[model samples]
Target: MAAPLSLRAPAATPRLPRLAGTIRQPLLGAVAVALFLLSWWGATASGMVARLFLPSPVEVAQATWRLLGSGQLVAAILASSARVFAGFAIAALIAVPLGIAMAVCGPVRAVLTPFISLLRPLPSITWIPLTILWLGIGETQKVAIVILGCWIYILLATHEATRRVDPLLVRAARNLGAGDLTVMREVILPAALPGILAGLKVTLAIAWSCVLSAEMVAAHNGLGAMIWEGKDWGDMTQVLVGMVAISLTVLLADLVATRLERALLPWERHRRH
Candidate 1:
């Protein structure tokens, strides 16, 4: 405080760390993955890891290459992707309207809540027995499982979001000569969109998992079937590759959803920092 050399000394700025925080986790993750692969290769070579149970990274890579070249993997991937899209789209279409209806019609929500609560906890696999009996073991049944998986999650999310949207916005809209439909369109939907999108993002991953499970039986082609067949033959390499593909696919989907959320919810984002 005593050393005032200049009338206007420059403001001091904190120096940035040598490593950026954003990339620190990614770098660490890469190193950890590399070490895991090295250890896996060593264990397989040393006979500590049985080939039937655990395959080397190189073996999994070779299996992936072979599946790709054979075109079987392509067919499986396409079939699974199609089922996922169809089911997920149907779920969104159904859930959004139902959620809105529940929000607007209090009695309707009260009536449905109990039934939905009962069903929501049930897993997609549990529905297989009933679905098979109700519907044939075909694309419809497979798609149904995915829809069942997606619908409840989106519905609950939408309902919660709608409830969370400020009531003052609705009152303001009504004060300005807005009808119920107008209020919903102008206030409720827009306000709840971010949460709804987040729910959809979560459901997309669930739908993928459901579709894989659905493909376990009766499906001639799909990633789940491929994995099942691999397991039946004790081909751990192929099983590992398929599992990796599924995980990577879900991660890519999550990334896309995050990007979409960022694009759509820019206002919420700006408020954060």
Candidate 2:
């Protein structure tokens, strides 16, 4: 017979190189930003839109520099950032433990679930008037707004994360003579950490937005207040500068959280790779 066809598996196709997880991805992101700037510059240069409505990127940059030189940008950033972190920290301290308790205790869940459900859908802005009335237009009110905006979401996320812990793992720990607290401390908490961290990252963003809203309405200084002032004066450049500052701050916060998540859950990172 024709020397019998060689019995062998087909050769696998060579995989194409991917840009993902490579330096090229960041380079490509830079390229995209450059293109956007170019287009924006072109639009402004060509007079496609009124400069009054949309200031050029250079104008926005110069405005940012002016604010920085005057120390206004720095102060606003510090004020807003402080409010965000303060509220977020307070929420985390309460919500995380409460969430864990709800997961582990039936009575706790029964007591909190209805209230969470009732209040979770309310937007942070809805609380502004009430907060001003109750807490006065002060830092306390701003921080409380952030807390009200973030805590329920954090609690819900923690609850879901706790619930998702595999029952088998808990059982195995218990069978090894672990008490409920031991099981929770050693097994459940680690398992739920990733989800909890992700939730915190999201809640941080929400906190920022809430603080901005609070500042816009009540505060004398903050990026949000800067934007509001700019709007009142019809200074598009100042408004754009505030917008950029907020965007950059949020981006940096997200990056920090992402790095922390990777550090805490190296196994998850490796598994994905």
Candidate 3:
């Protein structure tokens, strides 16, 4: 007798395609990096580029090792990381609630929209002169620069994310006897969270850039300070090492943010697969 179609087991999902996709992405990235290094090494070896102007990979690696051994690299990392964290935390604290309020309340939006628009167009670097004048080249100045550079973007992003939340969800929550705070907490926030997270990831990167810029101009110690000192002394290798350090730090931060996002929005991960 023929078995009923509904009762038959579903066809087994193929694992090979998923496995290949997982392997392919990193494999391609590794290949590209290898090729870039090979080209850079070739250029240096053939004397196509002056070693003083652009140090070879080997020289840069040696400088990195020396910095690591002397603990200067670790010190710079800590200084820069401290400023970044302090400023970013303050920005997040102020921006999130204020942004949500702006989105949910017309009076708040009308008051803040013009201020945000005026500041949003300014670059982080442009504030350096004023910050130095106001804050006097201290750590506070550095932190303030990062705050100014980051908060506007975060506020705008949060406002937009909150505004994008579906009205239907709020209405449904209200229908279910939810109050203003309850609807906001349960419906609007959850719906807006994915966008808010994406914005945070981007704004964190901007914070790093802002702190580095401020450090280069005014600070005595940081990755940016190291880079500036290297340039003054004509040490391309040290400059490259500082640049590499900042890049690695940003990469680590990004990885952490990505993990946090996945943990907060597991549904998005499932949908992607």
Candidate 4:
């Protein structure tokens, strides 16, 4: 007798390997950090590298504590953080609008593209001498360097994001009797926001790096200045402490950016899931 189709057993399906647990992510990160510290300690303890060349983690901790007690570390952090915030904020304000304009207007793009192409290839460090020449060794010079370093990247990212926005959504908004401004504000901006936010996060890191280069040239108080002072005095521990502070600050900033991105782009998160 022929088996009824409804009662027939289904063909065996292929089973994929189970994905790793979410908890494994944080566990692995912790394990990696612990291993790195252990290796560093082992190297220093075993004298694989001289203490002068590579200070022990314990020595760096001690130096950090000493700096904190003296309030120098806190002050340096504040100064550098302020510069990064100021520069990044200003760049975003200018770049965001200009980038959108460039994406929408051919004339604007034609005018700016050449200059951007020429300058974008140059590293932030290359601007130090020119900035010093133009703005002198003042806070303005440092801020200018950061602006130059970050604004181009922010502009490019925003332009690409704006251009990549789905045209169908724009057309639908227009067909629904939305004006150009309405379409832009309601449809375009929101659509491009995820990319814009991602670009800003990258620009923030570039701003930090530029600030360090600026401070290296001429600055009285900043993490970069602290590092330079340490180098001058051959204090590897102090340099290590400054480096650690920079790394921690950048990590904290990135964490905040991630939270902000998730909050601002809930749709993106939902889509990803």
**Per-prediction TM-score, please?**
0.88, 0.91, 0.95, 0.90
Ranking by lDDT: 3, 2, 4, 1
Worst-scoring 10-residue span by lDDT in model 3: 264-273
Q: Write the per-residue lDDT of candidate 2 for residues 1-273, one digit (tens) a residue.
A: 578787899997655455344767889899999999999999998999789999999999999999999999999999999999999999999999999889888999999989998998999999999999999999999999999999998999999999899999999999999998899889999999998998999999999999999999999999999999999999999999999999999999999989989998887896655
Instruction: Assess each prediction's global lDDT (C-alpha) against the native.
Output: 0.88, 0.93, 0.94, 0.91
Which ranges in model 3 have alpha carbons more than 4 Å from their true place? 1-8
Report lDDT (Cα) of residue 112, candidate 2: 95
Q: Determine the C-alpha RMSD for candidate 4 after optimal superposition of all C-alphas.
A: 3.9
- Candidate 4 has a TM-score of 0.90
Q: Model 3 over residues 1-273: C-alpha lDDT tens digits?
A: 997679778999999999999999999999999999999999999999999899999999999999999999999999999999999999999999999999999999999988987888899999999988998999999999999999988898999999999898899999999999999888999989998998999999999999999999998999999999999999999999999999999999999999999999987997767
How are the candidates ranked when ordered by TM-score, highest leading?
3, 2, 4, 1
Q: Model 1, poorest ten-residue lDDT window? A: 13-22
Top candidate on lDDT is: 3
> At residue 107, what lDDT does model 2 achieve?
99
Which residues of candidate 4, in runs, are more than 4 Å off? 1-20
Put down candidate 4 lDDT per residue, 1-273, tens digits, no spaces.
997679768986644322345567778999999999989989999999788799888888889999999999999999999989899999999999999999888999999999998999998899998888898988888888888889999999999999999999999999999998999999999999998998999889999999998898799999999999999999989888899899999999999999989999888886764
* Residue runs of model 2 more than 4 Å from their true location after superposition: 1-21
